[model samples]
Target: MTSPGRTERLVLPGVLTAEQAAHTVAAIAAEQRPDGAIPWFRGHHLDPWDHVEAAMALDAAGEHTRAEAAYRWLAAHQNSDGSWYAAYADGAADEPTDRGRETNFVAYAAVGVWHHYLATGDDAFLDRMWPTVYAAVEFVLQLQQPGGQIGWKREDPEDGGIDRTEALLTGCSSIHQALRCALAIAEHREEPQPDWELAVGLLGHAIRSHPERFADKSRYSMDWYYPVLGGAVTGAAAKERIEERWDDFVVPGLGVRCVLPNPWVTGGESCELALALWVMGESDRAVEILQWIQHLRAENGLYWTGYVFEDRAVWPEELTTWTAGSLLLAAAALGGDEATTAVFGGERLPVGLEPDCCTQP
Candidate 1:
C-alpha cells in the first residue's frame, strides 16, 4: 500500500502525475543504445557506475527489459579480470591512455543488481548476474590496503603508476555496503564467501579507525555522511555526524550543499544524504530533506546538477536522469516500500563501526 503522502505528492498529487513520471521514464529509456547501454548523457560516453544508476532508474519505473539490457552490456564488456574499463567511447571498449580502473565504480554494480532483484523479485536474474558481481567484488578487493580502505584506482596516466594510496573514506564506505550485499547474495545462493566477510570487517575497521588515512576532504558532503550512509558506520554517532553538519551545508528550501560555503548544493548529494538519514532511522528528517528539493525541480521532472549559493542554478545547465533516480530511491525509502526496505535490511543500520571519524573539531 502506498502512503497517502507519497500518493498525494508524487503519485496522484499535483506536483508530478504518473503520466509525467512515465514520460520521464520513456525519455530515459530512449537514451539507451541498441546494445542496451545508457550513456551519461546523449552522445556521451558510458561508464559502469552511471550506467547502473540509469539502469536502476529504469527498473524503478517498470522498464525491466531495458534494465536487463543495461546489465547485459556490463556482463558482455567485463574484462577477463572481472572488471570493466574506466570508460568507453562510441560504444567501443577502447583502452584510453588514462584507463585506470576505479574500485568503487566497479563495485557499484552489486548494489544495482541487488536493487533490481529486489524491485522485481526475479531470482533468475539474480542467479545470472551473481558471478559477474562476485568477480567484480574480488577485483575491487585486490586494491584494498592494510588499513581496510581500498585504494582509489589503478593505473594513473599522469603519474604513470598505480595510485596505491590509503583508502578514501567515501569510496571505502560505499564499497563496504557493496561487500555486505555481495555477501548476502552469496548467502542467498547457499554459497560461502569467507573472503567477503573478511573484506567487510577490514573495511569496516578502516572506516572506524583510520580517519587520518583518508585524504583531507572535509569540505565535501560525501566525506561528511557517506560512511554512515554507506552502512560503514551507524547508531548515535551517525546521528551526531548529521546534527553537527546540519546547519553548515543545509540551506533552507535550497537543499544540501556539495561543499560548505561553496555556493553549490547538489540534488545528488542532498538525496543521498536523505537516504543516509533514513538509514540512521530518522525518517521525518529524511522526508524534510526530500521535500526541500521539490523547489529545485525543473519544468520537466529532471533537475539541475546543483544550485548556486546566490540561490541560482548552475552547471551542466540541463536536466539529469540520475537526479530524478536518486529522488525516487529516497522517496521509496521514506515510504517504507518493501523493495527498498529489504535492500536496506530493516534500517537497523550496520553495527560494525564507530562514527567518530568526522566528529573532530
Candidate 2:
C-alpha cells in the first residue's frame, strides 16, 4: 500500500488536491441526516442501495463514525424480514413507502456491511450486522430459480413477475460476493450456515457455468466484466474475457461507454472497469482507466454521470454520488492509498470466488 502521504500525492493532482478531497468527503459526510441516512442529493429521498454506497464511500474516506451512523439508519429501519423497504422519502423513516422488497438491493447490504467491517475491523459492528445480512440473503434466495438465475424481485406488484430466470451476470456476480461475505460473517460468529454456503455455491455456479443461462447482454460493459468484478472468474479466463472485448467499448482519451454506440462515456462504468482490470492483475491498465476519469472531475471533486462523445464538456449535467464513490474506489485500488486500502481491506483488488460457471463439462 502506498504511504498515506504518497497515496494522497497519487490522487490529489488529478481529482482534487488531497486537502480538497478531504474537504469534499467531509462535505458529503455533512449531508447525512441526523438520523444517519445519506440521501443522493441534498434533501432528496434515500434509497437503500445508494445510502449504503455513500456510506461505504464515507468509510473509504476514513469517516467510520459517519459510516456506522449510516448503517445504524438502515438497522433502525429494517423490516421484520431483515430487509429494508425499497425506498424512503427524506425526513420520513417512520413512514417509508415500499417500492417493495427488491431481492438484489436487499442482498447488497451484506456486501456493504462486510466491506465496512473489513475496513474498520469493528467486531461489534460486524456482530450487530450479521443477523441482518443473513436474513437478507435468505429473503433474496427465496427468489432464486432452479436454473440458477434470480427472478430479480419478489414483492413489487407490477413488473414484479418473474421476468426471466436467465441469470443476469451482473446481479448474480454481486450476489456471489454478498453470499461470501455473509458466510464469512456467519463463520466469524462461530455459527453454522449451511444454507448460506449452498446459496453461495449455487450463485457461483450460475455465474461461472451458466453464461447461456443469462440474457445475452453483451452491449453493456458490465456484462463483459462483472463476472470478473464479482469474483466469479479469474486467472486465464479473466484475461481472455477482457482481451476479447477490450476495443469494443474503450474510447481513447475518453473512457468506457455504458453501451456501444451510446456515444457517452460514463465515470461510473469507467471506474468500475478500472476496478475490474485491477482484479485481473492488470495494474497498468487500471491506472490508465483512472487517468482517463481524472480529466472529468469537477472542481468540487464530484464527477458527472457521463460525457458526450462529440463534446466532452457539453453534457456535464447530473453529477452523481455513485460516480464520485466509484472514482474513490478506483483510486483506492489503483493508487493503494491508506484510506482506500483500509476501507477496501487491501491495496490490491479483491479476488472473487471461482464460480462453477467457469468449470468445464
Name the candidate that leads on TM-score: 1
Over 1-361, each residue of candidate 2 has an lDDT whose tens digit, in order, gives 1123422633634445566556557556656788788876665667787788778777777677888998888888777766666778776544565656666678778767877887788998998887778778877787787765676655544555333344567777767666666766677678877766666666667776677777778898888888877777777988998889989989878889888768888988898888888877787887777778766676665677788877646365765676777777766666664444432332232233334544445
The reply for model 2, stretches above 4 Å from the true place, is: 1-16, 93-98, 157-166, 311-316, 337-361
lDDT of 1 at 130: 92
- Per-residue alpha-carbon lDDT of model 1 for 1-361, expressed as tens digits? 1223323223423234565555556666666788887875665666777788778767666577888999988888887777776777644543332367788888988878887887788999999999899889988999877666888887644567466665678888888877777777787788987777777777887776678878878888898989887876678888888889888888877789898668888888888898898888887777778777776677655667787868564765766667777776676666565656655543432233323443344
RMSD of 1: 4.6
- Superposition error at 311 for model 1 (Å): 6.6
How does model 2 score by TM-score? 0.86
How far does residue 207 in candidate 1 sit from its true spot (Å)?
0.8
